[model samples]
Target: MNRFRPVRTMVAAGTVLAAAGTAHSAWNSTALRTPPPDPPPVTEYVSLLMPVRNEAGRVGPALRSLLAQEHLPRAEVIVLDDQSTDDTGDVVRRLCGPYRHARVVRGTAPKPGSPGKAHACHQLASLARGSVLVFVDADVVLASHAVASSVALLRSTGLDLVSPFPRQAAEGPANRLVQPLLQWSWLTALPLRRAEASPRPALSAANGQFLVVDATALYGCGGFAAVTDEVLEDMALIRALKRAGGQGGIVDGSRIARCRMYDGWRDLREGYGKSLWTAFGSGGGAAAVCALLVWAYVVPPLAALRGSRWGAAGYVAAVTGRTLTARRTGGRCWPDALAHPVSVGLLVALTARSWLGHRRSTLTWKGRPLRGWH
Candidate 1:
């Protein structure tokens, strides 16, 4: 067992190194370039849809940014107020008042089996009249060219759906440690170009923060109605699209949008806890992923502290992958990458918390009980 230990270390180090290489390749291949300052005219009518609930404090800037979008020949902005206890609806109405093309829609409570966000999105999609549907989250602020550039990429790539992952804005310690992992995990683990080309649902990924989809393909896939109960509805939507013979994948939207997902540590913990259980499909899958992450990222650092050269190499490789992902995704790179192991640990803890919440029937997001947890 002692002799085989060195071989195990070597294999583990190699896996980490391979992940680093994958991250490098994904960065080069998956980046979304800014469209030309003066691009061809877009004839397709685009509808920018947003669903807001308890976002009074943050929705203003995001809505303002959406309304300020330029270069769309024909466009409409539709915001659905999803029964917020706060002034979310009023705030959106005030911001949208001056824009004749933009309007606010009153949303009803979700059906028993539906998730709030998905239900809200389903309603917004039904109201959309555009040939293209761009869903922007209330917390996501877009650049003036965000809509135009994303539309250009969608048409140019011929993909049915494209998720431009916004640059995550992290402020607290918890945020800084875990936020970068959002992009890094997929960038290091998934083959970006292959995921786009493949029809396999398991190869798909998406971010709802700023997603662009062809309306026809979306309707064909059953739209948000197909993913009404999913906690991770963005991924579910993309998978549904692929299963329906449509192509969809993610892109580096850091240049075009930014989002701060949580207010602080407490908010971050609850936010992740609400949905992380569903991220892996099952508790067993969650355990496997946690174990794999620990072995690939956490174990090497511990062994390196014990003077193992192979372990040191693995640690370096892990950090290199994180650094590459950060550089590509506009995240904080330097000291944050060094804390990759901590991030993995926190993720595991969050996954565990998510499962526990489900078991106890305590899982909720924004004060609503999560549906379909069983």
Candidate 2:
């Protein structure tokens, strides 16, 4: 037994490496799905609803793109200024003045238990007049055919809701390093086809940056009002839609829509830190996720650097997965794929910050203190 110790060690290492490689392959194969095909003929009226607060500078280009939509003839654009302290309301009015169907709504203060953005979205949904509602973030710039393509996908697929995640336009170092992981996270973790078919909310994922939903289906799920206090309203809404027996899925909309979600490192940090705690369901879930991330992303690289051949293979597979996702989503590949360990480290830090803030009741966004998790 003493003489066979080396053999046992080798076997253990081999088993770990094999498991890692299998997991990597599973993730890589599912990383970048074929994007949905182009739009078929759809003449339905589409309403573009955006909720904004202190986004005076960013909202203009998004509005311009919405107004310039070519395929949808009877489209209307609605912008809800969620009690902005800046020139957001004025800017929206001035920019929308030229389009007859475009209008801006002044949002009232959120109720006692409601989250700000969710409340604003609810108001916009209440006022929407189209059968199809396309919720666009203030910073998202849509291609001329984006609305038509998205609506066509929803109609063609028979899904009640669809989040056409846009291509993230990362600027600063922090943005470039971290934002790509957004696309990669769901792309690798959740199998899109299975999520589309399953009604389990746990499997549901969505990006609120550019989401499309059937107005009636949204109403059937209690609308944004149902998720009024949810910090991750996108995920909450998707789960609600799924629980209501409605089907929806995410599609690669990198070619059709683009967004610069954060201006710099600080912006990116706070933006993510606000909701990271609740993102994983509970504290235990968050811990499990952290452990998995560290094991999957960090351990292999460290082991490789320490002279483990199996770790080297795992590292290669991990980088390959990141490269695949980046190429498909237009995210940076070179340094990011190589920097996976660093990215995981930063994410772990962010998660810790988020959890600490949640415990201390100090997590806030855009000047409002975040309410405790449900």
Candidate 3:
């Protein structure tokens, strides 16, 4: 056998695995079905909870969208103002004045060991009177039937929690390169149906931007307090819920909601730097994941430029998988998918910056220092 044959075989196998995963995700992925014209009456009460900090400029659309929700007669909207330096509280109060079902609560400083967002969520949970809770980010704008459709899916699937991932709205070049990776990461790497059926924490996936959870299971699993110090609290919360014998997973929510998470490259870098270090559990795991990404994505494209057949095949498979994921998740395909290797490189760079910040105790989000860095 040629000395480099094994290396080529490994590259080919990795590409094939990625292709298989993309195909499986596409085949089994579930979308939040549009509500029927006369949707069955919802009997369970729902609490639409929002946590905001320095979101004054953008919270209006999100609050408006929540207030305009249809088929949720027995629901209440609650916004927690997490001590924003901006007029977020005033903005929410003004918007809520016209809707009796909506109200704003001022949040206190988070106790030691608790992140601000988690503290706000915990406080909101305490005040909720509903059997179901839908946690939405201030940046996300929901469709009129988002809540109704999500609840229907939850009931139909018998899941304790479900994340309806919004269609990421990417603006500039930086966003075009990175935003698609949000859904593509899980879509290509995870088996969604299997994740829902399995209780293993490692098999779980979620997006907190528009998460719906059965309140009973949430409390039973310790709620946000269980993940108080977690940087990636959404994933941690799902893992905790699963560990408590509850089931949950992600679904396509592109048609029902959308969010633009970052403004540009600088904003995106800061947004990711604070939490990416904890994404893979530890420093070693982060390194391993980055290495695998480079090997499976970046290397093949480079070798393809040098006329290697296996390399060309691997690069094609990577692009094909990206295109499929984008099409499935309502992201920009075509030229964006062609830059898959560049996306992986940026992700690796962000991961490194995240680790550096973690080690130097420099991570922060929205003006609050991240605790539990040791």
Which has the greatest TM-score?
3
TM-scores of the models, in the order given: 0.94, 0.92, 0.95
- Report the Cα lDDT for candidate 3: 0.86
Q: Which pairs of residues have clashing backbones in candidate 3?
A: none
lDDT of 2 by residue, 1-374 (tens): 69955644553454364355446435644543333456654588888999999998888899788888877878789999998999999999998999899999999898653448999999999999999999999999999888888888788778898888899999877887788888878766777778875888778888888999999999999999999889999999999988898988788789899999999988988998899998898999999888777776777677777776656766777787677778877778887788877887788888988898888877778777776554
Q: What RMSD value applies to candidate 2?
A: 3.0
Report the number of backbone clashes for model 2: 0
CA lDDT of each candidate? 0.86, 0.82, 0.86
Q: Give stretches of model 3 more than 4 Å off.
A: 1-10, 30-38, 112-114
Better of 1 and 2 by TM-score: 1
Clashes of each: 0, 0, 0
What tens digits encode model 3's per-residue C-alpha lDDT throughout 1-374? 59988877776776666567557656655532332333465689999999999999999999999999888879999999998999998999999998989999998888664457888898899999999999999999998888888898888778999899999999998899988988888887877778886888778899989999999999999999888778788999999999999998898888889999999999899999988998998899999999988888888788788887777888888898888878877899978899999999999999999899888888778888876778
Residue pairs in collision within model 2? none
